[model samples]
Target: MEIFFCKSWFRAKKCPTEMWCEEQAKAAHEDGKPYTVLVGSIEQPYCFLEVTRRAVGVSFLDQLLRESLSYDFQEVEPGILFLTMATYREFEGDTGKVESGTSYIFGRDGAVTLRREFFNPQRLETSASSADVAANYSPKPEFGRYEDLIRVERSS
Candidate 1:
């Protein structure tokens, strides 16, 4: 299965990224498999939260149903139309917050799995001491590993 990532702000009207997602959704439906779409927009702060919140329990299935109806994809049974948003925020000094990155696993059973991460440099600083900062900060193992599973495309 091919995963698509749209690093553009989402629009209400059909955009190239959305069109690609729709096509992938349709193909997954035809193949009787799940579908996932990752979207990144710096302007939308709540996009990641909303997607994750809706993905817990039965709500995710309900969300997929609603999206299928809205996007006119007919029916997507036992499928997950996963969407995510990534953004970054910088502070006054050298501090910053990065809410970004997503991972996917293609299971042997033909299921799609997702994982997301949020990194905040401010949280790593316990005090003004460099030792404390060094002790608290460690590179995330999952960082930079998501590229193995996704294909990124920019919209015009």
Candidate 2:
């Protein structure tokens, strides 16, 4: 069976030109903010889930939440969340193919997490917003904001 790994992420804003991190790009241009600075392996098709399962005791989500604490969450619009899950695809003809495989966003409340499996790509689904997850998970303020990446790194 071809088991696919799911990569979940939240970007504060979509770049207008680059099509990703547009807000951050603008921030970099206007406020002189540094690169969002993703430290993970930029190599395409990197399996974070696999890495965590092999190297760490925590799950991928846990690692992500921990890392998110330092991202720039304040740049996003209030009440807006950009959640996405994508796979890595490589074709025989393509030399460099780390392009986003598939993704969906939860822009409203009451989104559904299909199959009840967080790692299942086919099971990854969303509603209009986070109301359902909030109701089901009984998320606290901290938990809700866990998705927010607003941490600003102070330069020495």
Candidate 3:
């Protein structure tokens, strides 16, 4: 039952602080990212997020299929593969949208390359905001407590 505020421009699992908006505000400001505070929680929040760098191994997918909230696996063409993940929790304000996130697998120089990367603060207009540290795989909201984070297999 931690406090997440609107002033917080960012949220991540395992965030560095419980009162992120308050404690980190100074650092975020020094880094040149200014944001207004808003009120939120796991059940009702602004948006959902996924980090591309936190890739789940291919072997894990088989088991994940059993618990995935909503998902789609397809071979668009040849060696290229596409995967879409959804929320396992049923909620009205959930951030995981159907097919909103994507990744690719392809052949590269005789080796297979899996290009799955979701977090990229550099690409964001507010790179300073990217400073938030997330302990969870992502900042997306869910019904359970952090310890009850969805099964690692199904989530990745």
Candidate whose lDDT is highest = 3
TM agreement with the true structure for every prediction: 0.18, 0.25, 0.19
Better of 1 and 3 by lDDT: 3
> Candidate 3: misplaced stretches above 4 Å?
1-18, 33-39, 48-97, 100-156
Mind giving the per-residue lDDT tens digits that candidate 1 earns over 40-141? 432222121111112310111112111110110111223223222211222233322234333333232334344444354323311111111111111211
Q: Can you tell me which runs of candidate 2 are displaced by over 4 Å?
A: 1-34, 40-94, 98-100, 111-156
User: Each candidate: RMSD to true structure?
Assistant: 17.1, 14.7, 17.9
Reference-based TM-score, model 1: 0.18
lDDT of 3 by residue, 26-145 (tens): 454344343222223433432212211222111111111121242223333443323433223222233332222223222222222223223332121111112111122233222222
RMSD of 1: 17.1
> Residue 122 of candidate 3: its Cα lDDT?
18
lDDT of 1 at 135: 17
Candidate 3: count the clashes.
11
Q: Give the CA lDDT, 0 to 100, for residue 7 in model 2.
A: 30
Candidate 1 off by > 4 Å: 1-21, 29-34, 37-45, 48-156
